[model samples]
Target: MTYSGVVKVGGPADVHELTDLMISKVAVGPMHNNAYLLRCRATDEQLLIDAASEPRTLLNLIGESGVASVVTTHQHADHWGALAEIVDATGARTYAGRLDAEGIPVPTDVLVDDGDTITVGRVELTARHLVGHTPGSIALVYDDPHGHPHVFTGDCLFPGGVGNTHDDPEAFARLIDDVETKLFAQLPDETWVYPGHGNDTSLGAERPQLPEWRRRGW
Candidate 1:
């Protein structure tokens, strides 16, 4: 949770062009958790990811970004504690993966499964199921302005550190394998990985760790 940075989600620079889509991450709450705001530059539409453990802070971002949806990466409290705040702020539909969908603490507007596509203006989010951190954990992929793929990996993967898999030791092992086989292996080497709570890193940076992950697999 110590790492932090902001990639301009909507514009090339301060211009906030509203042309290419934007993806920004914010660290909030007592847990210093990571949440994301994704806005389509062309449409000025926005979505919030993992609204965990903070209302005021989350609402402030929602107000600032004009988000239209609140999506969950998992059901853990640190990942979804701010659901109520995000929903109230944007009147945005809320979504969660099937396993964790019912665990969102409130009713969800959409139940997302693997291979689902969520459209927000010009941006389309493809949900990929990577179950290891939890029974239901998913990540998102979308095309960036550079034509490179980007992922909003919430608690699923971090810069170099992984999430709290020890809580469910066996599941954590599978999570690591899933990352190497399903995530790191498939995404472009240069694909940008926006972790749930740390500085961004490219897939190339994470690729080398796959063998170690395989060894550590449960």
Candidate 2:
């Protein structure tokens, strides 16, 4: 089937195959958190993003080819509900943003900052540290050589607007600024965005709404 990037809890994952990489996206847990299992076609090595919840389902999705690394996008409880469990089961190296590493219960093996590289075999994903959403929320960028860029935005971004700042103007401003400068300004409109929860969207689909989102103060 074609990769639509639409996944639901208790449903099958949506797989997107690139030239040298395979991305499988699934929704797990009560919050319907999205977890991505990335496998390198060349070396067969795998990396998982956001072990949110439902360890059993995640383990089942992993199958025999265990993951080599697990990256928690942020320190939010909903994002790492299955981090320690998945880590213990697969013995995968843990990675988190340096500023939010302390908040995650599982000891982060690698504390990442902006511009850090995480490899899945031959594929390299660049980390973009987006502050405001939990201080250390990060978005992973995979610039496909053959195609367009793909970004995994935890809770920092979604289709309509940036993540909730709980009416805090400063936090919202910081998030929008980082998202605009680091993501929107740097990447092209074709960039695919995989969020922490719910369905996916593209930069082009959201670009026109920047002014509206800012004005609404959400």
Candidate 3:
């Protein structure tokens, strides 16, 4: 199969192939949260992002590749609902933002602070601490040497705007500011954004809407 070609399970809408770094995408649960299975082609080692929901399904998808670690993007239950089960089944280490570690149901083996490096086989993912949607919301940055950078943004960012701040002005400001300087300002337009609960987007697409998003305050 080609790198960009998708493998349909039940349907292409449920699962797909990223075609880079052998990343696999799964959209599961009632909320349709996205979970990614990242495989390091160099070593065949794997890492899971979000764990999201559907323990049985996730475990089945993981199969025997063996996950090196499960990175919880944030403390939200929807994101980590099956985290404990996956960890128990695979013995994969757990990682989370230090500030949100206590809130995660499973014990986080590694406290990922901003700029901290998390390894998956030969690949290294840098943690970008983005506070707002939650006090310790984080986005993982994976700069693939073969292509453009890929950022796994939990709920802190999305295609059109920033995550919901519950109408809190301060939280909104903080999230937007950090996103701009830390993510948007630093990464190039080709950077891919793998968000928490929906389809993927690009920094180039989102960059132009920063002003509009700020004005709307969503």
Estimated TM-score per prediction?
0.85, 0.99, 0.92
lDDT of 1 by residue, 1-218 (tens): 22235433221111122247755566764666767777777778888888876677667666665678888898887888878866776688888888887767868888888889988777888988888777788898875656778788888888764666766767777788677777777788888787776567878887787677556653
* Model 2 weakest lDDT span, ten residues long: 130-139
Number of the candidate with higher lDDT, 1 or 2:
2
In model 1, the runs with Cα more than 4 Å from the true position are 1-19, 167-169
Cα lDDT of model 2 overall?
A: 0.95
- The segments of candidate 3 whose C-alpha lies over 4 angstroms from its true place after superposition are 1-20
Clashing pairs in 2: none
Model 2, runs deviating above 4 Å:
none
lDDT of 1 at 137: 84
Please give the TM-score that candidate 2 achieves against the real structure.
0.99
The most accurate candidate by TM-score is 2
The pairs that clash in candidate 3 are none
Give the winner by lDDT: 2
**lDDT by residue for model 2 (6-124), tens:** 88899999999999899999999799999999999999999999999999999998989899999999999998999888999999999999999999999999999999999999999
Ranking by lDDT: 2, 3, 1
The superposed Cα distance between candidate 3 and the true structure at residue 94, in angstroms, equals 0.2
